[model samples]
Target: MRHLSDADVEALLPPPAEALRLVHDALVALSRGEAEVPPKPTVHAPGGAFANAMPAAYPARNLLGCKWISIFPDNPSQGLPTVSGLMVVNDGRTGAPRAVMSAGALTAARTAAVSGACIAALAATGAPAGFTGAGLQARSHLRVLEALGHLDVTVYARRADARAQLMAWAEEHVPRVRLRVTDDAREAVLGRPVVVTGLSIGLTGAELDPSWIATDALVLPLDYASSVGPALARASVLAADHVPQFEAVRVAGTLGEYPATTTWTGSLLDQARPDGRIVCQNLGNGLSDLVVAAAVADAAEAQGAGHPVDTGSA
Candidate 1:
């Protein structure tokens, strides 16, 4: 088996432009009935953290894979990453496990790719000032925005130090872009035409005041917190990878205070194609993980970045 580290995944994965294109194409194909992406299922252990299993296949790309991504947000309290896991790819033609890969990099890349795609799509409408948020996911959004050619950017976090770190990193790595740190989340979203929120809300998801947004701005909630929030349903368009995951949990009485529906995002996107303030909520579909994992794996192999593992020994 091939084992990819976060660094390896970074080196091998498609550049931001290519990655955005791939993700956008995947989304379009999904809308057009060319892919199978099941809703992600989560397993909550006795501990506070949870693990999720996502599986996806792209017939167009001949890629098949699953990603086992675990969220141990409390891990940071123990001086570890908040999220960690691995990706497993299989032979689409033959039923065989092809590789075991690092999940952190894959997750970040795919998540960023989604942001990049959204940025590009929104830019065609008219480029916004930029987006803001604080967290690893927020960093991913910033990276994606920069990659997708959004030059005016600002980030907001509760912590001054953390915001400073991100600002410094942005300056060093993506110089052409302007960066700012603010205490007001509303200030971040107010004038910007595009807003990406990537904060952890445990299993519940995060929420932002709709009033913070200008009329008809595009909001992308990468975190599941919005799953139960009124802002999600009240948005002009509510697009999600699967209505089943939330509906299932709601049926089971585990997902508290969220409405249940079979409303798929593809349908909503089709309905609200050209105009309106839209919100895309991702419950993190398996298809996204699978496609991204395969792309990263292929990139790693071509670039000779990952380590070959002797899975047989294990």
Candidate 2:
């Protein structure tokens, strides 16, 4: 077996455009029943933290993998990463273990890649965008948005330091896009054609006013109902990457009073864009993890970039 560090995974990751293409393919396959992905099961931790076990098989692409990822929202205060995990890629033919790679970079990449696909398929290029949360997902999404030709973005972050840090990073990395930071949530989202929320899940009193969102905006909530709550989501054409997972989460009370009619995001890609507000809650999907992790494993093997481990017996 081979082991890849976070840095190695980051270096092996596909560019935003390529990443988006990969995720788009996976989503399409999933929609067409060409992949096997069980709903991810969650386990809880102290302090409102949780972890998920995501397993998926993409026989069309000859890929198989599972990711164990955890989100501890309070970690940042302790100078630790909020998200961390590992991915195990298996041989599609024999089910033999192939590689164990850091999941952080891959998770962020695939997530932003999914959002990129949504933006490309749903919204106009360079439309004004708003983002809530200035963390890892925000940075990753900024890269994707820039790749998709979105040049104007406004971000809302409660912490001045986070906003400043993100701004500085954007200036150096995504120089083409202009970023405006705001402390007010309404100011960030009002009338924006694209709005992405990445705030911590399980957060209360952080939901945006439904009136603040444009009637035709594309709202992508990566963080469940943390920032995009029930009332706001109820007013939109709600869609999710996996309707079963969304329904499960709703049953668990994460999404309260959500609209009964929900469509799969991939299905929307094939159909005419629905009129009115569109909220696509891309709850993380294992098929995406399988696709991306397989790519990373292939790259690692080709470049000889990871550390090989010898399992004595197997």
Candidate 3:
């Protein structure tokens, strides 16, 4: 079996544009009910950090994969990353483990690609757009927005400290994009026809002013797992990366009540929307991970990337 390190994963995966394209195509397939994805299950215990296992299958390619991700939100105290994970790729036919690869980079890439897809879809509608949160995911979305289209991205965070830190970093890295630190959610949401929220809203329970979202605007909440759905129920167009995943979480009783005109991400790709409010909530699906994992593995193999596996198992 091939093994890929984080560096290898970074080098092997497709470029941002290519990854976004793949994600767009994949969403189309998903909306057509051509792809298969499983719900991610989480287990938390006292004295232990939160961890999750996500598995997914691709029907078209006959592939199966899983990502084991853990979030030590307090890991910063140890000078470590807040999130870490790995992706295991397996053969659908024989169930043989084909590769063990880094999931962190893949996660970033896939997350950015999904954001790109949503931005492109929403941009097609011609409306004022804004981006909330200024973390790694928010930066990734900015990169995607730069590559695919143009949209005004605004940064909103609970702490002035975090916002200042992110703005300094942005000035050094992404100064071309319009970015401002907003204390008021209303200021962040007002007049923006499209908005992307990349923070862990589920964990923070941050609420947006209902009046800020114009009746004609569309809100895309990329982090849906921890999001309170009822707050966004009034949105006219509610699009999701995967309806089943949302339902699974709903069944698990994790998501509270939210009303929306339910539509899949695939639907956006298949047709065009003229107007009306559209909100796309991304809980993230395993199939998205699997597609990205396979692409990374293939690139690694073709380029002779990754660390040489030692016979430690032997």
Candidate 4:
């Protein structure tokens, strides 16, 4: 087997334009019912940590993979990343594991790519956008917005240090964006036509007022009820990366008090109205992760990247 480290995955990843295209195609395939994504299964650990297994099979692409990732909220306190895991890609014909690779960078990139796809499919580019909760996801979103198209953005974070870090990284990586950092969320969401938030799933204790959103803004909340409120999701012209996944969560009670219903996928981009809230709530499907990781693995193998392993089990 071949093992791809985070660095190898990063090096093998395609350029932003191509990455966006790959993610876009994956999402469209999901919308067209060409992918098989089972409901995610989670195993809770101590101290509010959990490991989630997200498996997806794409028949059209002849790819099948799974990402077994964990979120340990306290890892950062120990100078470790909050999220870490690995993705395993299998041969579609024989179902043998072809590669095992790191998933942190892949997760961040694919999340932003999905948002970028939604933006290109539904919103206009070159306008001012807003961002809330600056962090790794925020950085990915910023890079993606510039990659898929150019847009000036204003970012607001609860922590000044986080905001500063994002600014510095933007200066180094995505310098084209005219980024404005603020201390509060209002500056990020008010009057902006497109907003990308760094809200993690299941977050609570703070709520963003619905009135703060622009009348015709497209709210791209990558998280669940954590960042974008349930009330906000219901009132808006809702869209999801996976309709069945959203339904699964709703049925499993993860949606809480939100009135869950069928959401607009990419296919309805042209029909999406601007008069109300245009919300893209991506609960994130395993299929998206599988496809992106598989691409990285395939490319890495072709280019003679990553560490090769013996056939014996470790």
Q: Largest lDDT belongs to which candidate?
A: 2
Best by TM-score: 2
Number of backbone collisions per candidate: 2, 0, 2, 0
**Per-residue lDDT of candidate 1, residues 1-314 (tens digit):** 67777777767777778777776767666666678876667788655678888888887677888888887756766878778888898778764667787888778888888766765665444355544456667666666776666767766676788788888887887777778779776677775777777655453434566667756666666655532255544655655555566566556554345454434554544443557676666566667677777777777667666677765632
Clashing pairs in 2: none
What order do candidates take by TM-score, descending? 2, 4, 1, 3
Which runs of model 1 end up more than 4 angstroms from their true locations? 46-48, 123-126, 129-132, 203-206, 226-228, 249-256, 259-272, 312-314
Candidate 1: global Cα-lDDT? 0.67
Candidate 3 backbone collisions, by pair: 128-193, 202-226
Which scores higher on lDDT, 1 or 3? 3
Which clashing pairs does model 1 show? 205-225, 206-225
Candidate 4's displacement at residue 131, Å, is 1.3
Tens digits of lDDT, candidate 2, 1-314: 89999999999998898889898888777777788888889999999899999999988667888999998989888998888999999999978888999999999999999999999988977899999999888999999999999989999999999999999999999999999999999999999999999888777889889899999999999888888888988888988888788788888876877765478888887678889999998899999888888888989999999999985664
Better of 1 and 2 by TM-score: 2
**Model 3 spans with C-alpha error above 4 angstroms:** 46-50, 71-82, 91-94, 125-128, 225-229, 310-314
lDDT of 2: 0.89
TM-score of 3: 0.85
TM-score of each: 0.87, 0.97, 0.85, 0.92
Candidate 3 clashes: the total is 2
Show where candidate 4 strays beyond 4 Å: 269-275, 312-314
